[model samples]
Structure formats: structure tokens, C-alpha cells
Target: MKPLFVTGSSPALRLTVALLLSLTLIFVDSRYRHLDFVRSTLSVAFYPIHYLAALPPRLARAVDGRLASEADLRERNSLLERENLELKSLMQTHQALQAENRRLRDLLGSSFKLRDRVMVAELLEVDLDPYRQQVLVDKGASSGIFVGQPVLDANAVMGQVIRTSPLTATVLLITDAAHSLPVQVNRNGLRTVASGSGLINRLTLLHLAKNADVRVGDLLVTSGLGGVFPPGYPVARITEVRDDPGSHFASVIAQPTARLDRSHEVLLVWTLPALSRAGELDERPLDAAPPAGMDTSR
Candidate 1:
């Protein structure tokens, strides 16, 4: 019955009455603090309703925060992967620096004065031709590389450049049978030719007598007799000594100083022998006769 009476009230009359009452309240609130007390009381009464209205939005914000956390984790993982690759690259660079330092130390330790300019190049490819041991370098003529230029690793001489282009060059390793070097045994200063045997990591000491002073474990260095390679650069080490009674000369074997199977970086060295005014032939006194058991033919 009460609801029916409220609905049956004239709309215009109810609106006019509400407006007049609102004006009265406003005038009182402006002049006195009683309206503030009423507003506070109304807020207290509506607090529960306000919390109910905010519940859905708060739930939505919580879900969004969880999704954002997952996205952040994924982004962090991607960053870590990139950082790992960068660290790996840096590690490789560090190792290369260490190797270079050690090689330089060895060169200085031998009291070797290296006047030749050096070019750094990577070994691009290797050729195991059975008849020749060779490799291709990334450097070429434009890098100041030329035919007959010496190539070396951290340990010892590797080869000489045989061909060159603007972007690439071919190196003939010391293990190639066609490659020979004028070397002297560090132990006795006995000079001989060290020739490659076409075998991986094997060389031969050629023209040495049966009674030669060379032995296993002797270190061979460039004699500089041919003026092709710089003097005193490590060349090979004697590995086998065969003094067969039936053979006229000794069959000696050696291994090169360079890491033939594992070298990645090599130095292209440019050094020319100082020319003598003697016109390529210097008069040096000949040595005395050979030992009694030594055959003169070989």
C-alpha cells in the first residue's frame, strides 16, 4: 500500500519538492558544518556497497599482474641467452690472447730479433693431398702476402706461401716432400737439409752421414744458409735415428715444430736476407775430412 502511494504521487510535485529540499540543504551546508557530518554519515553507510562495486575491477587487475609477471620472465630468459652467447665470444677471445702472449714469450726467450713484419690470418681450409700437405689462408696479396713468405704458428714454422690472390692464398706446409729447409741441429750446429716426407707430422734430415752428430731429441733450427727463412727459427725435432749397416747413410726422421693438424691462426712473415756485396757467393773455408765410418757418397 505504501509503495502504491509513492508511485501514485504526481511526478512534477515530487521533483519540485526534491529540488527545494536540495537548495535548503546546500544553503545550510555553505553557512554551517552540519552537512559535513551528514556526508560522513552517508559514506559510512555506503562503504559496504562501494567495496562490492570495486571487487570485479580488483580481480581483473590481479589477473593482469600475473600475466605481466610471466611476460617479464620470458623477456628475462631471452636476455640471458643473448648474454650467454656474448660471454662465449669473449671467452674465445681471451683464449686467443693467451695463446698469442705465450708465442711471443717463446720468441723473445730464444733471443730472436724478428725484423719481419707479420700479418695475422686464419687457416680457411686444409688439403691432405697425400702428395702434398697444404692449407689455404684467408689473407691474400692485398694483405701484403706473397709467394715464398714464411708462415708460422705459435710453436714453429708451418709453411711458405706458394700462391696468392687478393682475398686468398695457398700455403705449402713443411711436411710436403717438395718442401725443404736449410736447418742446423741445435745440439752440434751440424747443418743439413730438412725435407718433408709427405706424411703428416713427419720430416726427413737429408744428406746426413751415418756418423752424423744428429740424434733423436735434437732440435733443428733454420740455418739461414739458403737465405729463404730467417735464421734460428724452430723447424723440426729429430724423432728417429736409423744407422743401418747395409745402408750408406743414416735414415733419420723428425717432426715439425708447428701444430700442423690443429693450427687455426698463422702469421705471415716478411723478411728478406741481407744481401752481401760478394755477389751471392761468399768464400768460406771448407771443413776437414769426414769421420772414418762415414760414407762420402751420401
Candidate 2:
């Protein structure tokens, strides 16, 4: 008993109508781009929700990138700092080597100025007594060092060997109170005796004439009269000259030219008489006849 209200469209007609409408929409959107405005409107309305859903993953990526960059920067800085320290260390070593080279050069240059066969020795000790100016050296009797032998530094005369052992020698500086040497005025050839005053920086010219030609800045050299030191070597330089009516001689003060308190190396000078020139020469003629076993000509 079908009712008359069931007079709606048949199932096949309804299905065909829906399929045709879907096909028409797909064709219109692909060919005419007519849905662009509608799509944009829908995206605007849903944008906040889409962004909220993506926020956590985007924030995590940004934080990770920042941390990685900071770590790389810290490692680079550490590497740079290490390289800087190594460079500084190398610079210091180079400076030290340069200074040592300069010192050695100075020492060799000074050796040529010596007039005797010289042996180099290092200073080992200095006297602590304020009343005496003396130093000990490494060369001794074993090295042919003897008492009264002249001792010199790189610049000038410092002392003479006063005591000796098998392995060491004691030198009495020119500034010792008991020490004296014959020195002449390099400027005017005025010979005088300079005696030490126990002070390292002072010497007194004894028995100098009141009208002596010595001046305040005159240079004094060994006179070779005493036979202890070589002739013409630097001794001391005059620093003060004073004349008194009551005294028979003028008083003069001088300072030694050598770096007495600061020198590290010293020279022991030996002035051995040279062999005669004829003996030193090749006395045997090259053309002289050879023995029976040797041929005269090659």
C-alpha cells in the first residue's frame, strides 16, 4: 500500500543529479580559477588555529639553531685563545735568543781588542765585606792563572789575580784599599799611582804634583811601569781633582772603566814574550834538497 506522498524523485535520478553537479564544480575551478577568493576567505578565518598548531615545532627549531651557533662560536674562541698563547710563548723565546746572540757578539768583539793571549772565565762569587772589593773567578792555577796576573772585563781592567787554587782564583779589584797600580794620563802623559779607596766606584791618584796636568775628565791608562798590567790598557777616568795648600800633592778621584759589580765574564790576560820573527818564519827553504828516499820534484 504505497502512499501518494512517496511521489519524490526516483533514486537513480537523484544520484545522477549529484554526480553531474560535482563534475561541473571540478571543471569550473581548474579552468576558470573562480574559487581563489573563496579559498583565501576560508584561510583567513582559520589562520589563528593553524598557526597555534605549528608554534611548538617552529619555536623548538629556532632554539636549537641558536644553541648550536653559540656552541660553535665558543669553540672558535677557545681555539683562537690557544693560538694566541702559543704565539706569545714563541715571541718570548725569540726575544731571549736574540739577546743571547747580542751578548755573545759583544764578547767576541771585545776579545779582539785585547793585546795578550786571553782565557775567558766566568765570575763565581763577590766579596760581601764592605771593607774589601774582591771577586772570585773560575780559572785557577790549573789554567795557568797566577797571582799578579791582570784580570779584565769586556770594557776595561777590573783587577789582578791575588790568590789562586787548583780550580779557582781570587781577584783583588782596583777599588780595594790595599790595591795600587801605575797609571798615566792618556791626555798629557802624566804618570801617577792610583790607589783604591775601598769603594767600588772611587780611586785616588797618590803623589800627584800640585800643578799636574791632570783634569777632572782625563782618562787614565796602565803605564806598564809596574809590569803587572799591559801598557796602554784603560784603567780609570778622572772624576774629581782638588788642590790644597797644606798638602804637598793634589788629590784626584777616579772611577774604574770596567763594570766591576755587574760583569758576568772576565778575561785573564797573559803577555808572553813573542818568539823572534826569524824563528817564527819558515827558515827551511822550499828548494832545499830532499833526502835519498824522497823525491825533490813531484
Estimate the TM-score for candidate 1: 0.54
Worst 10 residues of 2 by lDDT: 281-290
- RMSD from true fold, candidate 1: 36.9
Positional deviation of residue 220's Cα in model 2 after best superposition, in angstroms: 0.2
Q: List the residue pairs that clash in candidate 2.
A: none
User: Which lDDT tens digits does candidate 2 get at residues 1-298?
Assistant: 8896768899899999999998987888655546645544654565455446546755776787677876798998999999999989999998898778778878887432323699999876434456778886767677888667789998898988866666667788888876777889999898987777888899888878788888888999988666677778898999999987877778789999999998878999876542122222222211111233322111
RMSD of 2: 44.3
TM-scores of the models, in the given order? 0.54, 0.53
What candidate 2 gets wrong by more than 4 Å, as runs, is 1-114, 126-128, 274-298
lDDT values of the candidates? 0.72, 0.74
* Number of the top lDDT candidate: 2
